[model samples]
Target: MTSRTLLRLAMAGAVVAGSLTALSVPAQAGNAPKTVPVRLLALNDFHGNLEPPTGSSGRMVDENGNTVNAGGAVYVAAHMKALRDANTIEVAQGDLIGASPLISAAFHDEPSVDFLGKIGVQVSAVGNHEFDEGYAELRRIMFGGCHPVDGCSPAGPWKGAKYDYVGANVLFKNPGEKTDVTQSLSANPQVKTLLSDWGVPALPPVSIKWMNGVPIGFIGLVTQTTPNIVTAEGIKDLKFVDEVKAANVASKILKLFGVRAQVVLVHEGDQVTPNQSPDACSAIPGAGNRIATQVDPEIDMVLSGHSHQAYLCRVKDPAGQDRLYSQGGSFGRVITQVDMQVDTKTRDIVRSSVVADNHVVTRDVDPDSDTVTFMDFWRDKISAVANKPVGRISADITNVGTATGESPLGDLIADGQLAATKTGGNAQIALMNPGGVRAPLTYLTSPASEGDGVVTYGEAFTVQPFNNLMQAVTLTGAQLKTLLEQQFPGGPNNQPFAKILQPSANLSYTYSRSAAWGSKISNIKIDGVPVTDTQSIRVAANNFLVGGGDAFAAFKEGTDVWSGPLDIDAFVAYLGQNNPIAPPATTRITAVD
Candidate 1:
């Protein structure tokens, strides 16, 4: 059987112990029976970026307007260890792996797991990106191994993880279904042990944490949107339960087991602010800010990720009561810390009377030795490509838009995806998510008086981060109509984003501002011809979109489905076919006020 430390998965709770006295701060308004002071450190999204990504505009502007360099797992690791040394509990919301750089993703996110372990990531919830390579790979990394596909060493023996991962909502479709290999090899295959031996035995959900001298508990959950967002083939026999429902159920279970002072770590979250979002105790609701309101009352504080936003805002529950909420920005930019003071006498929490903030993980400290070694080992391998210049620029290709809606960078990518699909049948329409573009294009500068006047392969990768595949599918005018309707959430209660893309050329649609709220887009068409609302038209979008990434319920609304290859390959192919390829010679799409 695995030792207790190896089996340790998660924790959530309230406890009174002088152990935290050195790090204890003012109590937050919560209603702890007897407020016992505790310190909690949280981080999310880290996506396994060992080296600082070259062109990321991650340098956030602080209140003083000083933009500082941020990120790199080494700094993150060092920062996390500092918090723990202060007697604080370190927590990670989700997305500890997958969709990372070649060095990490190539190894099935092993480097990330190893780095996180060295830094002491006590517990983490599973996120959607966790399924990037499919369940088989996820199992390999989680249960421990070189992760067969990554070409790691030790040939075939199972290697256990240095940390515990939680999954409250991931369930087997049928009991007695075969588990992913690693799950089977989790404990002793030779001498059998109870199923619960590996944390969440029957159900892949469990809470294991210690607060003060009492065992605190935490419930882990992935979003209900998992099936649509992930590779459908991998999760065929598993079900992703509603996040809210799963959280509620798990909270009660922990309470039943005599564990109180619980917090939830989910791979889902809401609206975020920059590292500099006002130091207000409460957050206003918008796109991703509503997770706090959606959380179960049983949950005290929620550490959420997946939306790639950052904030230390609070939201009132269904009853107008406030709960602490926070999400660290993606790419290891920041580590959020919440200092809660619990009443030593009663186990109850103190309401909004504490300090919760996000701190920058500066590169000041030397990188973690082990993490540095792993990165150094992989750097040489990936540098051959990741660092090489793909193509050169003549003048400049930039998206200097400072507006909030969409950037010129966003438009450029949408055009690129469209260009790739249009080359053949020349797709009539193409859509790309705004979130897909990570950085603006920087033109190369002169050697003496360097200027950001050129774009390179490195710069291009910075713009389109996720390496998803491109998919070309036919969508009927009705599906097209649904695509436009997807711009806003429907019903009295719906999402803030309807998942509509700021599409490329060959497609033109306009909306009346005065039209009833969500039903905005009207004159949508293709080829200057009025697109029949029911007539079918060819559409090209990335595989992530075909599979539904940002709550696009309509893309899947198609009748015939064709899942082919990588979306990035389409881009590479487009550049290859149109060698000496140049950015679009004309502006593709325009949005009117």
Candidate 2:
């Protein structure tokens, strides 16, 4: 049995002492019921960044407009421990792992799970990235076992996470038909074993926490749009339900259990402000805003993630009462501290007394000793593979694309994919999706003691960590035009937001936001020649797009398909071939809006 199973078993019968002082009411009444002061520490979208992030990705603008170096498991753990007390319970919104740096991803994200356990996380919501490797893989990570393919790490079999995973809105499907709606969730093999010992369902819809004879309910949810963002194959067997409905149902269940205080942890959020302060609540808006306004009034607070931006806002519930809606910035850069007063007799929150704040995880604090020891253990295991010099750059090649969707790093990646698939795929030009570009090739970042402009395999892995295979396909000029038009804001594709694809140097096009969806792209050219409808072009793209991953359905219509090496391999090879590479000009996608 894993430590997480033991933790759950222990929690089943444990009662934590409450530190709340009794409420002072009218003297006419014999002593009024006491109000327990409860502290909830929350963080979200920590995408396995064990070390301090690099370049702009690592720095956040403070309230004073000064750049503050932020993020690192070491500092995050330190902050979490310092703020924790008898009245505090640590929790997270989601995305604790997946799309991580090589140090963690190479080990199937075990290090991240271990670090979270060490920091004393009691419960966490399931983020979309949790499904990146498929549901079965996620189960393996949660239950503790050897990797079915790679087996265990040098440290031996995995012990699983000490924290419990919750997803009230995610359900299993029976092919095209839905399963029994009335049936509660069944835990997986590991969870079954653990629950068998606790005499409860393998997977409980809500986690009930007891503190000083008071019970608090926690419900976890993911965005309904998860199907569109995650790989199709990974989530084929799962069905994502409506967030508002799921929360309402779970709230009702908790109410039946005599638990009136509730918090909803969701994996969807919005980017309110680019340089927003940790505690700022101005102009907060996004999909999360919609969900926050629609959830049941019984929910006292909603913590969110996935947008990677930070903001603290209060949305009015259906009853016209204000409730908390907040998200901590991604990558452990920020933590949300929520203080609530609960009425002991009613076991309900004194809604008006709730308060929340977002704090930056500054690098100046002394790192946590345990977090450092844990990181060093994994860092030493992969030192040779991680420290190897792959290539060099004259300056920073960032993934922050332009309004037209063209970026220097994207262009370079497209160029690399083109070079990689030239012979095997007979490719003429290449197209890269902007989302695949994770981070920049910074000249100076943490562990940059080696000096600037040096690019290592680890850094390159961080830039293109998906490991998507390179594919070449044949598309008519008209089809290629359709592909470019898909980048617009509105279309039949029903894309709520714009996602532009980066084109190789050999390809160029002009677009206008004011133009209709189908007519937005114009003057499309390949190799400096005007593209004609009758011409057939060979284009290279990562498997994600060619297989219709980012709604680029036009690529799915292509014929004469061929596959090549992984994208990371192509990028590393390109760097070696073109030593001391410079940033490419971002003139490919010209926007006329």
Candidate 3:
């Protein structure tokens, strides 16, 4: 059959099995003649953090709810090698690169990708952050070559990522054009390259990876909300489809190739109960759960990411049978081990025997020498610039956010942006999204100790690594209120949780959780003066936010925008001006409930 005919048949199969009713299986027929034990190791959201993360970002709650330091590619490599067996397959949920630290971002995350290859990640899901630099950059990341703009790094030309990136739900969309190509993604250069690398696009979707004579089909899907969170220009020609629909279709297609054991590496997950153990699910009811419950039963295991919460769950599929749904916490902090038993005769998984566990990448173990050597090579390459002293701090200003999402580090970043735009744009207020504050400004962290009060350029870059330019925009008091309301959950955009923005010293507001959606915020004041509806104010924020990133749609309505310095540059300059910076009080955003 032609490729088009095969595509038509696969799509038809997806429609017929979309709402499959029966997932119940008969009791082990005749004692199950032959069985194979397969071990799967998984991680997610590495974000190019080669070294150990600092403060709360590096810490993870243990099974007993006690926090402990747990991350670093060296330790991750040690753990993966220790757990590897003849039947083991290593994989990641996604966000392995984009939004990285200075060490990796300096060379465009090539070190992290190379480390992943050495550590043996066979495949990974394509995350929303993967599209941050647009499709062309992603191609470079996957297919090795010199960066199109920056030329080659000190390590010479890029060698590309070793693992395959699969996205069943990501498709090509041409503007103002109509064709049978809605589900056709072959037009995309990256997709075309992936197809050329692995033919038979439909049977097992993007690709089918095998382990020890047993085929394990992988179907990767990113959240449909990707477009809202990513830059509009980066993905204007791409479409992110429903996770459940895509996984169901992919599962049906995989079964056609007699690959009964299927695993979905999805870049979407649920938020767990705060301060709880990493293994506890605790009645979670978020997007991950919503997708988990709706996917087809043929999928044996689901590995997820994006929410960055570590969880090992057994949510019921459409057939009402429990299937493994797991996520490893971000930044290589947590690794999930899933063991499955498959029957040789039926070539299907024995769902009842499936088990999973999430292990924290504890620092107690010795670091892997090879990984350490690799990291050291890159560390030495970027040392002179990374180790330069930027400023001093009175104490540790951490990114450990409050229940209301305010953090001392976030407040400090907002202050930096406000100071940056004050002279040029006459900005009166600044807002910093909690997600942008990647790490803390730790006073005496390990791996890079620059005395108790001293801060380095590398640390500042690690904290604000997106390198987004600062912009001052004009927003009416009414529009500002709308922006604040958008910070909470259940807005027009379906943000899974509340992302309370960090505001500068002049901007203060009180919000109540008990109030209704539109009326949750009150007591809006700019420098002690109550803001009025008609009053226009100049506010400072990164280019990402002013352009409606993170579902802040009201920001897109701002008028007469004035651009300023790069976020990291402004932060460094602010640090230099305010030597011996102290942790700011978290009183700006008051919570009533």
lDDT of each: 0.60, 0.80, 0.81
> How displaced is residue 231 in candidate 2, in Å?
1.6
- Cα lDDT tens digits, model 3, 1-593, are 11331123233232233231212223556765477888889989999988888788889998978899999989999989888898898988889988898889999888899999999997888888888888768867876889888899988988777777777777666434333322343433443344443332211134456554456778888888888777777777777878887787667656655668888899999887778777777537778888888888888878899988988888898898999888888999999998888776666888998988899999999999999899889999999889889999988898888877899999999999999999989999999989888888877844566777889999999999887889999999999998999988877865667888999998999999988778999999999999998999999999889989888999999999999899999999999999889999998999998
Write model 2 residue lDDT over 1-593, tens digit each, in one string.
Answer: 23343124235332124111122222333565578888899888888899888777787766566779999999999988888888887888888988888998899889888888888887888898888788888878888889999999977899787777877777666433322222222222333333233222223356767665577788888888777666777778778878887788677666654568999999998877566676787535768988888889999989999888778888899999999999888888888899888987777889899999888888999999988888889899988888788888998898997877788999999999999999979999999988888899987644835567888889999998777789999999999998887766577666667887888899998998788889898999888999998799999998878877767778889999999999999999999899899999999888887
* Candidate 2: regions farther than 4 A off: 1-33, 175-204, 445-448
Clashes of 1: 44
Tell me the TM-score of model 1: 0.77
TM-score of the candidate numbered 3? Answer: 0.88
Model 1 residue 448 CA deviation (Å) reads 18
Highest lDDT model number: 3
Please give the clash total of every predicted structure, in order: 44, 0, 0
TM accuracy, model 2: 0.90
RMSD of 2: 5.7
Question: How do all models score by TM-score?
Answer: 0.77, 0.90, 0.88
Ranked by lDDT from best down, the candidates are: 3, 2, 1
